[model samples]
Target: MLHLGKPLVVAIDGPSGSGKSSVSREVARRLGLAYLDTGAMYRALTWHCVSHRIALDDAVAVEAASRALDLELSLSPDQEYVRVAGQDVTDDIREPAISSAVSAVATTLGARTQLVRRQQETIVRAGRRIVVEGRDITTVVAPAAEVRLLLTASEEARMARRGIQLGGSQSQEQLAVQVLHRDAKDSTVVEFQRAADGVLTVDSSHMDFEQTVMAVVHAVLDAVGGHRKNG
Candidate 1:
């Protein structure tokens, strides 16, 4: 799938806390390609709806908000950000409030369709050579990508990593709801926990961060025959 004299596109799908975002960013940096965090796009929309007092269950209103959302995401690995309505919301979208409500916005088929259209546009605008990572990237967003991978970890590992990131602020029960329950809800919309046909799986259950990064890097290199400093 290597295009002659063009950048390579990499698509990664995984459950939450599977390290797909970090690994995809690192791989894009090493490959000198742009990195697109599709999940952040959803989070930004969720934030907008909540801030505007739009009820997520109102599918029509949510879809309208999605259509009107002035969202922009930077694909640069070193300078990633999300902007909405000319406001910088790079960090706000990661707040716990947004995390808890994002699925409500995401599971709406109308909202998901709007976001998926925008995502495809972003990929095309990148000349089809950016590394895009999210829940459904490999299966729905970029199935034709040069390199497609599903990064996964055991539930225990996922919960542990998320717990460390949350800094023990949430109890185990809360963490389970955030990790497992959220995955269960989101899975109803898109298949993420399993590898799709032609997509490689990278299990990082026992691997450290650096190891996971290398695993993805190797997968991309093996699929597209690209050379990198670390490779």
Candidate 2:
């Protein structure tokens, strides 16, 4: 599971608001590896579509934009940026306007492929250790990854976390409805992946953020130990 010289590649996947970002960041920090947030890639593309007024339902136009994208994802202790071509559009992608339409753009097969291909390319370049986190990393982008984890939470908890992030001081009554709607759509994705297997799963519905991060970090370290013994 964990190999020392080969680089400890950790893949963390799950639904939205499941603390994937925080967990992945902490795991990468503790392990001293780079962290990749694949969700931000989707959000960056979604931001592009909105900025250009591309029709969310028009796959052709969306694919064209995706194909032409020169996006960059950078994560540091102090800054995270999703760069579109040359512009840093991290903050732009998180606005409420982009959030409403992101699922539509993200769920499209063409859009996902466009982003996933780039993500896999980044893995090839990491060379050493890396922690990649996103909804599809386990099932798609990093299927051969040594350490895979899926973190999930109840719909109620998910919505509450998202609402707090949305405004800092806010309520989930509105976000919860949207979260449920997202779940309904994402169910189809799970069904579509019926043939997938071998992903370690975690239900963080009742877990605090620190607990969630520790769980994932421990999993990665355990895997590294096994990787060492195997060698």
RMSD (Å) per prediction = 2.0, 3.7
Q: For model 2, how does the per-residue alpha-carbon lDDT over 1-231 read when each residue is reduced to its tens digit? A: 544568667888777777788778877887767888887887888888888899989998998899998888785523577888799888888776776677787778887888889888888778637889877787788888888887888877888888777765444655754566665675665422122477777788998887787777667767656422221
| Per-residue lDDT of candidate 1, residues 1-231 (tens digit) | 344558578999999889878888998887778899999999999999999999999999999999999998898999977999999999899888898999999999999999999999999998887999999988889888888999999999999999988888988888887789899999999999999889899999999998898888888877777664563
Residue 39 of model 2: what lDDT?
Answer: 75
Q: Give Cα-based local distance difference scores for all models.
A: 0.89, 0.76
TM-score of 1: 0.95
Name the weakest run of 10 consecutive residues (lDDT summed) in model 2.
Answer: 187-196
Cα lDDT of model 2 overall?
0.76
Error of 2 at 148 (Å): 0.7
